[model samples]
Target: MAEVYQRLAEHLDRLPDGFAPSEDGAEIRLLKRLFTPEEAELAVHLTLDREEVGAIAARASLPEEEAKERLEEMAGKGLIFSAETEGGKVLYQAAPFVIGIYEFQVNRLSDGFLQDLNDYWSTVKERKEPKTINQLRTIPINESIDSRLEVLPYENVYALVEAHDRFAVAPCICRSRAKKLGKGCDAPIDTCLVFGDFADYYVRTGKGRHISKEEAKELLVKADEANLVLNPTNSMLVSAICCCCGCCCGILKSLKYASKPSEAVASSFIVEYDEPKCVGCLKCVERCQMEAVTADVGGVRLDKDRCIGCGLCVSTCPTGALNLVRKPDRGEKLPETFFDTWRAIAKQRDAA
Candidate 1:
């Protein structure tokens, strides 16, 4: 039983995000909490690409009916990814640890599970290799962008929302975990948005509530009003958007203390401060999640390197002292779609 979990952990570690082992063996413990011996054995046979039941059964050397039943059970538990084709054929695939299995466990989090997860996270070492791709990218809020600037459709949160037909709203899992530990803030809990197939999965699994496209846009507005940062998947065809808060989001919390927060995220724009137009209300300082703005004797000081271009400060600036400007030579172009983004990350990880 334990050997099966070790194999599963090794398999997961080969994924793009890489499920690294911890010093205290919390990774294996987490796997034990989430997967049974049979389930882990079956999971080791699965790959990233979705496969039909018969094909998966052959790969696992199990009878078709047994494989199907076990696969469905795993999918229901959010341990694997499943999707139905247009012709009503179901497909199953292995899900990564982050942005996949972990996110899918939103509705099923328990205190013991969270403790194991936190233990694993604490001992996980930072990647020594430079990141060539990111899972999420920051975009300025709808109210923050200057109309005169030419914004790409992908960089506009409203346009991304408009492109999607199906939407679902889920409770922010990071905040949920924080609240479970009695350490979170008062930010809205139901701010995470899923789209298209991912949305359908969330709704089907009872992890999230289906919402209209208009409702999703409204939620984005509400998130902005609540001073949450908008971070969509790093692809033009975004599958989800996270309305993150510095107080609750793990990504934001880690970046908050970093010497250069902007370097850690994929963002197209940066905040530009107009010193002459500044009224020293220090409103921007309060709205900034990255600690990018600070109040000085001479007025507000903008630390360009620390800003992730979230536009929270820009949207709420009383004197219009802050505005978003496109970065010169806007880094690498985003992947065309979410799958492409994953492939790119996989290739990068392989090369590394």
Candidate 2:
């Protein structure tokens, strides 16, 4: 196995556009456990809808039976499978970590990338300052799905803007991601919230504005040149933005510098903790991306000032120890903004 791995390593004299093939990293470690070196190598080579036997022949020059057998063996290991709808054909892909490793160069970052990005975060993005949804103007971010999600901002010092979009359907790709401790990331922006349909997002709901399809394409090109990855799913262009905590959506596990939500992203809302019913199980603390909870030999503590008021930590509590309270000054109640925007846009877009 080591010999095969070494042999392949020598072949990768250079990486693809901003991409590294595979090696011993968190992602590669995951793939290595799931596949043999030969299979893994082939896994990277197979195109999305390409045939399994042809892909192996192209990469390994193996005979049909051998390649087919190997592909089936991998299928047994869940390494390969036949597509049901798109192609009803055998195709192979690298394992999760292998794909993640493939994403790493673009998703995660190295040390030098992090330093340069941090510089951009503080100087250019200005994410640490509190923000208002009415004033936010940039790309138009929209989502199709209404389940839990997070939209990380790019202007804050942290370079990760934790947000969620509440829409449920999408016509493009599946998901977007944030800068995971690396290069080519948007400067983290202060977190903000979006609600209603697309209208309120540009007005009172969130920081970003709706983008034209052409503009959205331009943004993707811009991110490409900077080596940044947007929602591969492109849901942002289809849905509204949300502020969420770690206990719920996938992003905003933590703010980069502050243990709690930054002053900028903190909700115009707050979460109150009832110590009398609190069991001190550390669940809230674990789920609070804001780190608003603390203990000092007494019981769990909720720092009202630190809570962004996404109300996530409260949802998971066992003893009914928490609840979310709206902050009157935090953001605007823009239901009219939503109706006006959606109506106007629908009128214009549909009329056209």
Candidate 3:
């Protein structure tokens, strides 16, 4: 039975987002925590490609009815992915552990499960996924960017939510995991925003509640005031946005140690320090979650490679010494749609 889960972990690692094996097989232990022996065996037979139950059963040599029942159960448990076509045909696919199954387990996650995950993550010394293929990107606070710059509608957080009719609010899975571990911060937990079909999934699965567009805007403001990083899905049409804290967010915490963190981020802008207006108050240094600001000979200095251009520092600058500068290195272009974003990611991950 343990060996079955070991194989399951290896199988999951081959997926696009990846689930690398940790030292001493901590990754396998985490898998065992999430799946039963039967479920583990069933999962190893699945692929990232979506397929009907009948087709999957044929491939696995299981009865169609049995396969359907098991697949539905796994989907409900957030161990697999399922989608309904417009004509009502249901399809199931293998889901990646982090941004997929682990996140979907919001409603069903237990303290024990979180502890196992924390243990597994702590044992892993290196990043599991490559930096260039991140699923999320940091964006500036809505009003922090200079109005003169040609900020695209998708670059603005407020416009992004207003463009979507469906909105849902869910607990921050990372914060929730921290809370269960008894080391959670005072930051708000229910700050994760989802949209369109992703919003519908959360609401339908009891993982989150439907929210109005107005309420979504209000949450973004509150999150900004709390110094949370606005990390939206890396897509022109974002499916979700996360209000992240450096202390709790897995992505930010990992990037803190990287020598070239900016290369990992998909930010459109970078923080610029105005030496002429600087007062050396060090407010921006204290406000930076990425540790990108520092008190130097000339008031403060911006670590161009460390800053993710989140604009949190700009909001706390009393003398207006900080501003978000559009990165000339980037062409100020984004994918036209979410499909394009996935296509680009697939190429990077070599899954295309």
Q: How close is every model to the real structure, measured as TM-score?
A: 0.97, 0.33, 0.90
Candidate 3: which pairs clash? none
What does each candidate score in C-alpha RMSD?
Answer: 1.2, 17.8, 2.6
Best by lDDT: 1
Candidate 2 Cα errors over 4 Å, as ranges: 1-119, 122-131, 134-238, 242-263, 266-268, 329-352
User: Sorted on TM-score, highest at the top, how do the candidates line up?
Assistant: 1, 3, 2
Query: Which residue runs of candidate 1 sit more than 4 Å off their true CA positions?
Result: none
- What would the per-residue lDDT of candidate 2 be over residues 1-352, giving only the tens digit for each residue? 5554443333221111112233223223333444588776555554323355776676777777777777766544444333222345545533222212222222223455444433432343222322232211122122211124332332111121133323221111011233333212232222222222322312321223444334333443333232221222112222333322243222343332445453534233366777788877776775655567776455687776566554445656777777654445533332232223233333333343
Q: Output the lDDT of residue 253, model 3.
A: 87
Error of 2 at 240 (Å): 2.7
What is candidate 1's lDDT per residue for 3-93, written digit by digit as tens?
Answer: 9999999999877688988887899999999999999989888887889999989988999999999999898889988888889998998
Per-residue lDDT, model 2, residue 112, is 52
> Using lDDT as the measure, what is the rank order of every candidate, best first?
1, 3, 2
Please report the candidate that would top TM-score against the real structure.
1
Report lDDT (Cα) of residue 294, candidate 3: 82
